[model samples]
Target: MFKALVVEKNEADGKTSAAVQELSEDQLPEAEVTVAVEYSTVNYKDGLCIGPGGGLVRKYPHVPGIDFAGTVETSADDRYKPGDKVVLTGWRVGEAHWGGYAQKARVKADWLVPLPDGLDTRQAMAVGTAGFTAMLAVMALEDHGLTTGHGPVLVTGAAGGVGSVAVAILAALGHEVAGVTGRPETEDYLKGLGASRIVPREEIAETVKRPLESETWAGCVDAVGGPMLARVLGQMKYGSSVAAVGLAGGADLPATVIPFLLRGVNLLGIDSVMQPYDNRVRAWKRIAEVLPMDKLDSMVHPATLEDLPQLGRDILKGQVKGRVVVDLNG
Candidate 1:
């Protein structure tokens, strides 16, 4: 028997509890790989899955962690073996199937990515899905020919996981970073991540009075959507693009096409779930090359399985910053 954090619905009580339970491999889902989960991370989606009807989790007693890193404890596939370190993201495993909020996980062999040479299990989880999403955003911007010479890149939801990493990455690559966040206190933190300037959330969230506005940014990594994205679309430099990665602000995008027709601004949508394997490999390689561990370490908070319930709730409320790496072995 292996220890796992199992979620259960007590229908009469109409509440959920995440608790340690002994489970057998036979009870685990049928998959080619079995990972001894060393670390997992809490993300925005995890919060929704844990909370009341975030419209993500459809059932009770679910183990919800979208990203994890660990060693292969068993493998029926030739590509992996016992002691092979691997990482996982996407594949809709956490929401639709079982996930990493446990001591062990069984998953399809094709879903695993070999741990890039420079990172360990903990650090891998530190990047997790959030950082992977951030990496993808940067790559999308790069494909659009965004560079330091074009002026400052704007990162919305700058204090959150994806925004925080994007801020550091773009800045590290010699581009100026202008961060937008709702919290004033995160100004210093954002600046520390190399944000050259801080743009108030209100600045971009205001109702757009014009179809387009004065060009303000080289490119954008936007985690908040809705009106915020609508406004950012208008203010982008000619031919610039915004990598839309999250809908924390809201889903409805009340926007105009003037930015697209007139300035040629592009809105690139990024989904970490089900990205092609080659692209996933390239992203992790890029992350290994570019991500500064010191900065990643600075943005992290350590948690255990016991803390996930509260941490998950906080993430949904937008109260959590950086990353929450869950040390399952602890």
Candidate 2:
């Protein structure tokens, strides 16, 4: 038997509770690949899955971990075999299906990617789904004609997982990175991650009034998609792009199309889940080559299976910082 964090619902009260339980391999859902999960990570979606359904969880008695890295223990597919290391991020594993909050996980082979060279299972989990999405955002921005020396590339929700990695990667690529964060205490943290300037959240959190602020940011990787995103849309430089990754603030977009019509601003929607396999491979390989390992190390905070419950609660409250790497064997 192996250990897994299981969430069960109290049907009468319509409430949920999570606990670590010993489970057998037979309990796992049928899939082509069975991974000996070494490490996983906490994400915002995980917070919802660990507590309430958030419309993401399809059923009860579920496991909640959006991403993990490990060695393949068994595989029915020709593409993967025993002893090969792999990584998984999207495809709703922790929601509609069994996930990586356990010592082992069985998943569709198509959802797995070979772990990039120079990254161990633990290091891969350190980069998790959040970091992977951050890389996607960066790639989207660059594909739309963003380059260094144009101006600062703003990263909204800068202290969070995606923002942190985006700031580091953009800075590493010789771009001036500005991070927007509400917490003043994280200014130093953001700067340490290669951010050159720190923009207070309040500076851009308000709804757009002018609909065309002086084209300030050369580009943006936005994880906050409410009014903050609306405001940033007006601030983007002419013909530049803003990659919308997450909706931490809110889902509503309150703004005008003047930025698009007048300044030629491009809003790129970045979807990590359901991404084509070829693009996923390209992003992972780029992450391995571009992201500095030391910066990635600084973003990591270790946790065990037991710690996930509280971590989930903390993440929902927007109190968690950086990345929380969960070691299955810890």
Candidate 3:
């Protein structure tokens, strides 16, 4: 038996209470591999799965963590074996099947990736979905040929998980990072993550009267997708691309097509979940090599499984500071 944060719905009322409950090995879903899950972290998806806002959970007694790292304990497939370290993310495993919130997780072999060098299980959870999404955005921009001389790179939601790592990676790769956040208090914090300057969320939130404004960003890793994303589109440089990762502000994108037709701006959508295995492997490997650990450390804090309830509430209220690493055995 092992302990896991189990969310059961009040069938009569549709509310959820995520309580730590003891579970047997058979309780886990059927898959080709059984993992001794070491660490899992809360992402925005996890917050929703734990609470009501996200509309992701379709059943009661669900496990909500979307990302985890662990060691293989048993495998029916030849691709992996016992004692091998592995990482699991995306794949709708948390939403459609059992996920990584417990001491054990059985996942499809196709959903697993060999943990890249330089990142242990705990550190992999430190990177989690947030940092991995950040890496995908960075790769999308770099693949679009964005360079240091292309001008200042803008990162929205700069103080959050994805923003923090995106800033660090872009800066580490030689581009000047302009971080956007509503929290003025995190200015020094953002700079310490290699952001060269801070742009108030208001500065980016303000809408442009004209369809196309003076080109400001060479490329952008935009995490907030509302009017903020809509506004940023008008200010993008010619032929520049924006990797849209999250919709923290809202999902409704009120944008004009002028930026695309006139400036040749590209709106590239990035989805970490349901990502192909090869892409997932490449992104993780890139994250291991390019993400500045010291900078990433500055963007992280330690949490425990017991703390998930309150932490879930905090993230929904926009009070979370950075990546939260959950030490399961602690």
Q: What is the TM-score of each candidate against the true structure?
A: 0.97, 0.99, 0.98
Better structure of 2 and 3 per lDDT: 2
lDDT per residue as tens, model 1, 138-174: 9999998887788899999999999998998888888
In model 1, where is the ten-residue run with the lowest total lDDT?
49-58
Between 1 and 2, whose TM-score is larger?
2
Best by lDDT: 2
Q: In order, what lDDT does every prediction score? A: 0.89, 0.94, 0.89
Residue pairs with backbone atoms closer than 3 Å in model 2 (clashes): none
- CA displacement after TM-score superposition, residue 140 of candidate 2 (Å): 0.6
Which of 2 and 3 is the better model by TM-score?
2
State how far residue 201 of model 3 sits from its true place (Å): 0.8
Query: Which pairs clash (backbone N, Cα, C closer than 3 Å) in model 3?
Result: none
For residues 97-189, what per-residue lDDT tens digits would candidate 3 score against the true structure? 788888899999999999999999988998998889999999998888788887999999988888888988899888999999999999999
In angstroms, how far off is 322's CA in candidate 1? Answer: 0.5
Candidate 3 matches the true fold with a TM-score of 0.98
Q: Number of clashing pairs, model 1?
A: 1
